[model samples]
Target: MVNLINQLSMPLVEVALVLQKHITALMTTLQEHLDAAQQSANANVVKPWPLDVEAAESSTNFPVEKVMKVVDSQRMDILETLIRVTLIEIDASIIEGLLALRSWEHLVRTQLALAKGPGQLFSPLDIPEDW
Candidate 1:
């Protein structure tokens, strides 16, 4: 029974040692990855938009001016088209609301006409004076 327990415990000890080694290696790898990520983050810090523009301008090899002009032109065209579409949608909504109002007015006028003859305007409701 003692030998059998020793055999089982020896394998368990070996497995524990192997697991510890793997854990240590994993920790070291994770630390190395963390350091690399930190270094990369420091190296690749993002500049502000104005600084980015300045950098682009300073890099004279690229045609930044022409690209900007084209982009601006396209942007203006898109804005104009969007504005026209929005105006058309707004006009359609206004027309729809006006049509609905006109329909409601017609219904109200018809009801009022049916309620009274041509020159009489008021409706009398008979109510009891008691609370």
Candidate 2:
């Protein structure tokens, strides 16, 4: 029984370990992208205009549209990363739930077997036919 439990649990542990590694990789990638985007934006800052009347006015005026566009684009990228991470987390939860269910099923079956004594046996057919 212990061996059976161990065998069933080993795969679940492996899957969790793999998922952790994947999440770590994704977080690292997200950080790198964010850093690169920030550096790119900073490096691409518009230069000040010449001292002519129109140029001076334009330089002094706030570029609301350009700033908004940069903000929106960066927000979208961050949202995308968040959505991906959320999906990974949901998948991990599902896998963990399945493992828990399997463990519970094994425990119930073991209890039944012990209660029914050594020579006696239990089978799936013992369950209700409708089930």
Candidate 3:
């Protein structure tokens, strides 16, 4: 959004920071527009609004389906944009995302265990009827 991409200089760190800023802004915009889907994702990415939260999941509101539609529409644009970038930059971003996901998984597990007690602890992978 800031147009900080100095192509002449080609500073990887500066470019990456610009990209990260844009991504964060985009995510913030999406979350504002698709709050229900965002909330469901934050609660459980795998099962997504699998709990009693389905009461609000209607066609009128932001559904995961709608989110997918929005994303799918831009899929090609995303690919096209990424295609211009160096492979190392894309790989670095992806690896960073994966690392963040791993850390998030651990944090979620720890939070769940603390909330439910040791005996009631369950892995997020386990598809239990109740969370």
Candidate 4:
């Protein structure tokens, strides 16, 4: 029986390995970006029900009331921005995962082609010969 590794095409295997490495690197970068964004969001997130709404409503001084409203509005804006950025980072990570999966599938196909033959690799409409 032939050694399986010997039957593998070296150049094709090397290319697949390079593609896997690049996909891994991309996934790492995406995860790092997501982690950083999540950390920022956690740091800035404020739990509801702590604001002094009753005090602000009952306050007679115009200046104090206006400052409180402005501060609250600004905080809301910052939270919204954080949420949007975090979501974008998460989406990027998902895309990276998909890319890695596709690369892995390609590697499987190539390996199968090397072990068997090109005709046995993939067919969308027909089942593989091994099955």
Candidate 5:
């Protein structure tokens, strides 16, 4: 039988292996962010936004199914969908924070894919721009 690892270039294979280690940690972080959001919602949703948003913020119900899907897959795309859908469900006029957490995660994966693909610089895997 052909080895699956052999199908990938060694650097990319290693990157995948490295990323596998973070699924659990990222899940924990995902939960923490959700918890924080819940806390903010519980405390004062209007404060998280701005202006007279009490009317707009009165209703918010994150879909359990979508959230559970992200929890199961531990994928950023799924989480992004959950965030976007949930915000839309609540009719959020403006979001206070951006979700570049997933984008940063994606950039790391991209860098890994380009590890040996071409002229790639050794960019530090640090937080990109902002969280």
Candidate 6:
């Protein structure tokens, strides 16, 4: 592996580096989105009280109706944003993984060709399942 990396041309090495950076960034962004989703979900606490208006009015323990209404509104907005962001992040991560896989595959093919003649390269062989 060291020899392969050392033998790679500048352009190929740059390609590998770019792919690594993209994968790292995509993973970090995905983690941030997951954290944002958790924070949004935890931002609101739901408390239920007896439905009787007299009891609800008499108790100051329960949240005020106005406050509950505002909280609900914010919760809806957060939920919408979370869903959109999560979907976008998931798509980006999948694409990044695929890109990295493709890049490595190409690099392996190039390295193999350099190590052995093209005619001797990539022969199909069956391996025993048990090593």
How does each model score on lDDT? 0.32, 0.35, 0.34, 0.37, 0.36, 0.37
- Model 3 alpha-carbon miss at residue 5, Å: 6.6
With candidate 3 superimposed using the best TM-score fit, by how many Å does residue 30's alpha carbon deviate from the native?
Answer: 0.3
Off by over 4 Å in 1: 1-10, 39-131
Model 6 agreement with the true structure over 48-122: per-residue lDDT tens digits:
111222211121233345333433334334433443355466774444443433444344334433433322222
In model 2, which range of ten residues has the least summed lDDT? 43-52
Give a tens-digit lDDT track for model 5, residues 78-111: 3344445654676643312223223333544555
Show the lowest summed lDDT stretch of 10 residues, model 4: 40-49
lDDT of 1 by residue, 42-124 (tens): 21111111121111112224344543443333433443344335435667443332343233233333333343232221222
Candidate 5 lDDT trough over 10 residues, lowest sum: 1-10
Backbone clashes, candidate 5: 0
lDDT of 2 at 57: 17
| Clash list (residue pairs), candidate 6 | none
If ranked by lDDT, best first, what sequence of candidates would result? 4, 6, 5, 2, 3, 1
Clashes of 6: 0
- Flag clash pairs in model 5: none
Which ten-residue region of model 6 has the weakest summed lDDT? 41-50
Tens digits of per-residue lDDT for model 4 on 13-51? 333333344445555665577688884222111111132
Runs with alpha carbons beyond 4 Å of true place in candidate 6:
1-10, 38-131
Q: Is candidate 1 or candidate 2 better by lDDT?
A: 2
Alpha carbon deviation, residue 11, candidate 1 (Å):
2.7
Candidate 3 local lDDT, 1-131, one digit each (tens): 11212213222222332344444544454456567565522433222122222222223333445433433324334433543354336564433433333333343343333433322222222222332
lDDT by residue for model 2 (1-131), tens: 22332333322222222334444554455447667887422211111112222211122333445434433334334434443455566674433433333333333344333433321221221322242
